[model samples]
Target: MNKSTINLPENTIFEVLVTTTNNQKPHTKPFGMKIQDKQVVLTLFPNKTLNNIKNNKEFLIQFTLNPLIYTKASLNKLTSKDYQNNNILKEATVILRLKVNKIIEQKNNDKYGENIITTIFSTVTDIKQENIQVPAINRATTKIIELLVDYTRYNYMNSNQKTSYINKIIESENIIRKTGNKNHNKSLNLIKKELNIED
Candidate 1:
């Protein structure tokens, strides 16, 4: 999808189902896809998903609003029924079939602890939307994604960066308080506890 077609919040971590074929078999995993000038960008660390994409240049990104599905995918416990046609997720609100246009490999010494990383730019070949009504506000989803980002960076951050990330989490908590529902509160509380943050 292009910029005019898909509009997500600034710095929003878009959690989606990505299907890749490995050894003539399909594997579904969750990833954060960003939009950049008619291309979907994926900054991925070395893993099974990266290997699959390296072998097969085609994959599908499924946009879903089901938080449970996101959680399951993150935990690597996704069910077979979560996927349909072995390429798209049944719970997806929208689907985009993409082909890799560019793959840039880099090594990071600090941010990623000297790990090999791949940045993928894929073109949208097709789109399948299920008449999904766009929500005016997606604060809870944004907050959850932001909190997770902060949690992952907690150890790598320097003093200043650590403070900034903590401040961001506090801001997310305030937004959750103002706009989040029961599910949001539950997720926030669990994340806070997981990150060793006090109520």
Candidate 2:
């Protein structure tokens, strides 16, 4: 088996493309893959990506720091032109092809009240670095994606749980403060306003 070698940050948002059994065009969505040792794991809720992965047994994860892509993807509103230009993969400094290794199911959680979630362990079958230029390390985009994930669960969470996620966003703001550039800061500010979080 080939070993996965990319050292990705824990919370970076990745654009994952999962092919549908009935269609030629692949489904592109934003996801976060956890890297442990030489393996990659994805914790996904019941969604098209999870279901497609179960049937297809393969997926592609792309690493991009573009906040617009993250935002549009989270809303399931990415334009066809975006894919035509290979913008996601091009902007992505690296990409990984993973084959499913294992799937573990987690029971109901009190926090988000999700009935069940699936954790998938996959082996890295291939790795591609689309660009060799200096990659942007700013994490604002990922943090925004994380915040959106939390928002999805907000309806299921209790007051304390919602507060917990809000605090997580606040903590993320510190990292944005450190390495985020003007675009990152602009994105963060917009998200903060949308969330009605006062500084």
Worst 10 residues of 1 by lDDT: 1-10
Model 1 agreement with the true structure over 28-68: per-residue lDDT tens digits: 66678788775788988777888998888998788776554
Error of 2 at 28 (Å): 2.7
> What TM-score does structure 2 among the candidates reach?
0.68
Model 2 steric clash total: 0
Q: Distance from true position, residue 104, model 2, in Å?
A: 1.9
- Which candidate should be chosen as best, given TM-score against the real structure? 1
lDDT, candidates in the order shown = 0.71, 0.66
Residue-level error in angstroms, candidate 2, position 155: 4.3
Backbone clash total for model 1 is: 0
Instruction: Show the colliding residue pairs in model 1.
Output: none
Off by over 4 Å in 2: 1-4, 7-22, 84-88, 155-199
lDDT of 2 by residue, 99-194 (tens): 899999988666455478899888778777765666654466567666766665666777788788778878998887676667567656765665
Q: What would the TM-scores of all predictions be?
A: 0.68, 0.68
